[model samples]
Target: MQTNSSAKKSKHILGLVIVDGVGYRNFLLSDFVNQSLNTFDEVVIFSGLPSESFEMQERANVSIVELPVFQESGKTWFWRKAKEVAHMQLHKYNFAGIDYNLQKNYPITKTKRALITKMIFRITSVFHSEKWINRFYRNQVSSFKKDEVTKVYSELLKREELDLLFFTHQRPPYLAPLDYAAKKLGIKTCSFLFSWDNLPSKGRMAAPFDSFLVWSDLMKKELHFFYPETKKQPVEVVGTPQFEPYVLDRYTSSKEDFYHKFELDPDLKTICYSCGDASTSKNDPFYIEVIAKLMEQNKLIEKVNFLVRTSPAEDGSRFKEVNKRFSFIKWNYPKWELTRKDHPEPWSQRVPLPEDLKDLRSFLKYCNLNINMCSTMSLDFMLFDKPVINPTFGTGENDLYDDQKYLRYSHYERVLESGAVAIVKNEEELVREINFSLKNPEARLKEQKELLELQIGKPLKGTSQRIAENLNEFSKA
Candidate 1:
């Protein structure tokens, strides 16, 4: 780590980069921006969102800059895809999720792109060393820096005179030029690992940084295991601000208010079913039907109010038929807007509304039990000491995408071992587990605490402050 002695004596400027809705929610919507402003002289946010849609409470010593659109050449695209395939080939044997994604994405197809990608995979598989992976990564980064976007970002950074560049998410391909520009201008850079499963299942990051911010020591170990090159860089475990809203008073609503707003019976216990995106959990409607039918038949131990919160990454139109059939199931569509309609990826363009934070917090606070395939909502509900039920009822061999395989992934193995949540494989097990959980919500309280501690190293109350302090310390190192 290089120490900036001048930064300690003079004003320090922090450049915060947010590329998507999740990042916007985690950093700008949280206390991270306020904490950073308190630590640094000025805080500039380089955002991928449109200026009109960048909704945040204005503050002094804070500004927002719209990032330029990155245009990728054919060579850069080829190198990027090749690097992803090569990385999966290198570690597919160790990570089941990576193996599944590799097999599912690049199968024996007849398309020209698939054929070319497979050929790249084969050639890279021969030289399956970390050295070769680094070579591929360098090729992609070098190719990306040649674009005009790099010059635009370089000029912006120069004008801002940034002491440190911080990235909220590390995997967006569009961020390569910004990262490269920061490094080119001799500015310190840092990135936060996006999610627990990102290191093992996702491919290589867009670029390397001087420091890394992770959620736990477990994630730090995983980073070293996957990318040994990061051993020399500082990896700080500051925890994530995603669950901080659960403890914040502003994001909470009274149970009566929540029930009345959602138009649900206050007498019945609430069971929330959080849906995955369209590609990850295509059979969510089937699962919804199973629970609704059980509720209709009076098969459960008690009558309960059912709520479904669809993924913010996708619209809820896919569940229109199911919603119509199960009129009893209350729907809580996430309040996320598509700010950038022309963006290549629709998921990246969706930004959550600030009001959704209160709604989500209320849902987590009041829900008696949460049901999903394999999601981080398990952690969120567990944060509130609520029971969670994960249903894996389909076979990968027969189904288009296997929800069961998620149970065997490297990141999820700890959840299974901790026994913090019930894993129900079939409808009978799901019914039995739901009944058991309702009867004994605190049965796995100890395990949930252990799992939460193991996954989230730092306390959740001051996560944003901790992260900001670490960034300031790293800047002055």
Candidate 2:
């Protein structure tokens, strides 16, 4: 018992990861992990499936204990993992069963072929859609999977095992169970407010930790609204982790190559339309479709250039036809560990920075303006006090859960009203909004100043330190 207790006392800090979003989570999670390694005694990673995220994860830490199917010899652990998958799969496909029963109860199965086709499609979709695959992987290994892991750590504690623990998400699909179990076992635990889904509503912002670290108030407000039940926990709103790389890249940049690469006018304004993965993407008028059609019909306008951001999984499927007529920057999603291997020096610093990125910051930074469908980039542009255009496209006639409707941009409507954004409804309106933003630059700049006022005096740095500090407090509390 003394030895076990000594072991527990010896090293007890872990940065529990819920898998990095491919490379997206790299900078964000890495900052925490690297910093934790320096500050904490132990670091544990919780990740998704191997085929999807294994390579990227192990790059950070080889000790990653994957969720259910993500383990190295996953099949060997089937019995142990099966029940976990079963429970999680039930919750994910719960809606499917309910829908299926409703359909059959209505005798819709008289068309057996349709059912077969749908089943085939669902199966196909699981592999064909990276987004769907990601969702499946996340759900299957959910935050509860952490619960099982916590049990493992607790038993190991008897053998002198345990340490600090950190959680990655905020709600239903997350690995919160691991967090709860760890807290109960007296392990230090903390959660990174990685997305808008976990935000509390206006009233639910009870503090969930001795220190809750978040990117923006969007998270705080959302957490407050949904979990108002918890008394307000100590919270710190840090700037978006994604911005760290951008800022780092910016500090070392000449930002001039953009003009040479595009071979375009030196004086025109450029607006980057960053495409984010949102439920809205699949539904609406397919962004490129509307943009291309508008450009062809003569409304895309002059003096303003648009650059489309592409993801690793994006196969010109969304933009091939559009590219035939217009040009775009194949903006690679900036990855952390991979960046060193692939792009030794990021384009952000290369001599001629990408032109279409407005001049002020990233090409997405410009004196004229920047636009996005529902991307969080739009939020970043909001930082410049410039106009960001958001065009709303409904993903479904009826929202499965309105919150499920690309809740990534929670304060979206508020930002628009705050003069930080202009919400355009369709292609025609989008073209018009873009034209208006460029033609009236001064108006947009004024609004940019307005938004900056809100950012000032906010706790915007040292999220890692704050997180470490809070984890220490939570372990005691």
lDDT of 1 by residue, 1-477 (tens): 534545433668899998888988888778888788879988888988886666454577888889988878877877877777778888999999898888877757788877777788778778667888778878888787767888899998888888899999988887778888998999999999979899989887887788999999999999999889899999999999887766777787899989997888999998899999999888788889999998998888999999999999988999999999988899989999999888887688788887899999999889899999889999999999999999988777765356888988988888999999999888899899988988898999999999999999989899999999999988888
Candidate 1: global Cα-lDDT? 0.87
The 0-to-1 C-alpha lDDT of every candidate, in the order given, reads 0.87, 0.47
Measured against the true structure, the TM-scores of the candidates, in listed sequence, are 0.96, 0.63
Per-residue lDDT over 4-72 for candidate 2, one digit per residue giving the tens place of the 0 to 100 score: 566556665454655334323433333555565565666556554233344443553325555442221
* Model number with the top TM-score: 1
Query: Where is the poorest 10-residue window by lDDT in model 1?
Result: 1-10
Global fold similarity of model 1 (TM-score): 0.96
Off by over 4 Å in 1: 1-10, 107-109, 398-401
